[model samples]
Target chain A: MIEAIGVSKRYGETVVVDGVTLRLPRGGVTAIIGPNGAGKSSLLSMIARLLPMSAGQVRVDGLDVARTPGAVLAKRLSILRQDNHLPARLTVRDLVAFGRYPHSGGRPTREDAAHVERALRYLALEGLAERFLDELSGGQRQRAFVAMVLAQDTDYVLLDEPLNSLDMQHAVAMMRLVRRAAEELGKTVVLVLHDLNFASCHADHIVAMRDGRVLMQGSPAAIMTPEAIAAIYDVEATVHEIGGRLIAAYFA
Target chain B: MTAARDPRLVLAVLGALALGSAALFMTWGVNGAWGFALPFRAAKLATMLLVAHAVAVSTVLFQTATGNRILTPAVMGFDQLYVLVQTVLVFALGASAFAGLDRRLLFAGEVAAMIAFSFLLHAALFGGARRSLHLLVLGGVVLGVLFRSLAGFLQRIIDPNEFAFLQDRFFASFNSPHHGLLAIAAAMALAASLLGWRALRRWDVLSLGREVSITLGLDHRREVTRILVMVAMLVSVSTALVGPVTFLGLLVANLAHAVMPSFRHAHLLPAAFLLAVICLAGGQAVLEHGFGFDTSLRVIIDFLGGILFIALLVRGKVR
Candidate 1:
């Protein structure tokens, strides 16, 4: 379970994330979706402890993110930011192996190697495991990063804009992987996504944020209403239950 | 694809090369009495090894922390600051009083000041929700220019004899090893290596950048600060001992990275250290035997290293 209590982030005069209190459900896929500058990424980063909060506190499984040591939280939680630029030359497997750093401290044990292999297989990147990151396409590189985060084997996974640079096919595949992580692995997966239809079809719960605050939160069926979609994003969209899944058609 | 050469094998080969150069430098053309030649050569060898290790370790850690290969601790104006400190001492107290000051004490003071400068600069530039490394580097470059100009101004106004003494004190001289200061340099260098070993594994992870490193459970800011302090220690040790061999670190560090395909610092550090040793010891040998001491080894190193730096810039890999 992840809980944010009156959390806020202020950069000088700009309040990026306003004070908000919420508890995210465990063992489910929760997607935070909002328009640009909606503070979705900022909120997710605060919960992951990747960004410092200017006010209030965040707790993960009864551990205060502000007070707990990073090493301790690392074992139970992991996060992937949007952009990852490595200065050193690293192959895909080499990078995935680093996901076990909290446990191995750079010395990969046999068990850590198993995790790396499993992650590579899960992302369907076994063929490219030996390929350098610079040699891969944007989508493949994005999957490689996602593979690293999954190899962390944390109960709570937070990703900020994981779908960026990914094509539609890869995007759907990524959402399915996130669902599998929640269902099969029993992990709580939280991600900030911009694509409304993808969030509606894949997420168990949808969090709509706007102007640094949560505008609405509920099941996809509840939040998929036309007014709610318009309230979140200033666009006219029709929500239709197709094959028992809420699909938003904002095109046209 | 050509299989990558095992970094360990490269490390071994470089180690052998470093040793070969060290041996050649130690005994190359010693026609004098064995007793007299051995101690003199040994002292110089010890100083060279200390400076090489300092330059290697400091450059590796600084580049890791900054995540850029082009910026060494020298860019922070440490070498120039060292010269400025020496100049002010000579200008204020004269050569007699400066010479009378214990060399070990002066060396320790310089190291302390260098460490203090890193801490102060980091604290002042790294806060306010802005960990802008660009700002830090810009500030450093600006301050480096300022320090150089101030040192130049002081040099012009000082007495001619004092100026000459300061010049002698400033440029690195490989031929002369102040044997009295070797023990102090060795002790400090050893302490630095111990701490460096403890943080060795973390350096590879650090190269992944701050967000990923923190997500991997490292206190990135704190760890970077620690590495910078160690870097400061090393820069101070080498600069104080040999009057600041500015380009040696850049030359050897990049060479190590280019030669080894591995990303592990454990492998990279040794390769870099051996490269430094080979460059300095081998160059010293060539300067002694081939050139017959007609030219300074520092000039040769700076000349090669400067060209390499410009090449790296032109290649557009630094960004």
Candidate 2:
């Protein structure tokens, strides 16, 4: 479980994430939906300890995120940020193998290699494992990043804008992978998503943010209503239930 | 991606070539007394090898910390800071007093000052703001400009004879080295390399960049500070021993990356060291024996290195 108590981020007089307090339960896919400048990424980064919180405390499984050693925290939690400017020369396998760094400390053993191989296979990157990151397509490279995070074997995964550059097919595939990771592997996953329909259809729980505060939080069926959507995004979007899944048509 | 060459084979070839150059440098033009001439040549040989190791390792480490192949310690003004120290000594003590001071004391003072400067710079820039690596580089470049201008102003105001003496010390020279200074430098470089040797794997991860390194559980700030101190010691060693060779590190490090083409520092570090050895020893042998000291080794190296720098820029290989 991750808990943020009065979390806030400020730059001088401007507050990017202002006084956000929320509890995120363990074991499921939780999607954070918000508009631009809604502080979705900032909140997630603070939770991951990538960004320092201004006036709040974040604890993961009773361990203060800021006080805990990175090595200890890395074993329990892992994060993959969007726009990873990595070296293009690293092979998919080499990149994924780094996921075991906290455990093996760069000296990989047989078991570490097995974990790397499983990650590659799980991401369907077995054929492209030997290929360099620069040689792969955008979707394949995105999958490679996911494979690396998966190989970390952390119980909680934080992904910031994981579907940023992926196409429709790849985006859906990534969402499915996130769901499987939560349901099958019993890992807790948090994602900052842009598409309302994707978040509504895939996420087990949804948290809506506007102006750095949680506008609403509940199951998709409750948060996907027209009133909630208007209040959160300030757009009058009709919500339709098709195939027993609440899908919001916010584009039109 | 193209087929990758085996790093071991490349390293072996570089090691052999470096050894061959050293052998050739020692053997050529030994008509004088064997006992008298051998130690003299050996001193010069040891000096070249030490400078090669210090400059190459420091450059590679600096690039790793900065996450770019283009920026070396020399480019960051480390060598310029050494020059400033030398200029200040001459300006304060006058020519005779400066020359009369104990060379060992002077070397120690220069090295200590450089390390102190690096620590101050590291703390001031990286302490509170958590400034990015590029910002630090920009600060270094600005500081380099300040140091160069100050040194130049001092040279202009000093006596012409003193200026002549100072000018001679500015350019790098491998022809003659102080035996005492060479011994101290070798010990220091050896110590730094030992520290570097244990952290070779960590360096490989660090080269990935700051965010990735931190996410991998490395204390990025602490690691970068340690690497900077090592770089300061190294830059001081080479610059104090043979003066400043600005482009040698850039040339050697880029060549090492090109040849090894692996992210692993285990292969990259030795490859850069060996390549530096080859460039210095082999180039010195050719210039000393073949050209009869008609050309300066620093001139030739900077010429080739400058050209390579421009080529890298044209190819957009800064990353």
Q: Which candidate leads in TM-score?
A: 1
Residue A248 displacement (Å), model 2:
1.7
Predicted structure with the largest lDDT when compared to the true one: 2
* Candidate 2 off by > 4 Å: B89-109, B120-140, B158-172
Instruction: Kindly list the per-residue Cα lDDT of model 1 for residues A1-252, writing each as its tens digit.
Output: 899999999988999889978899688999999989988998988888888899989999999998899999999999999988675568999999989999888778999999999999999999999887877899999999989988888999998888998898998899999998888889899999988888888889989999999999999888898999999898899988899888888899
In the predicted model 1, the residue pairs found to clash are: none
Score chain B of candidate 2 by TM-score. Answer: 0.88
The TM-score of candidate 1 is 0.93
Q: What is the C-alpha lDDT of each candidate?
A: 0.86, 0.87
- The digit string of per-residue lDDT tens for model 2 on A54-171 reads 9899999999988999888889888889867666568899999999998999999999999999999889999998898888888898899899899989999999999999999899
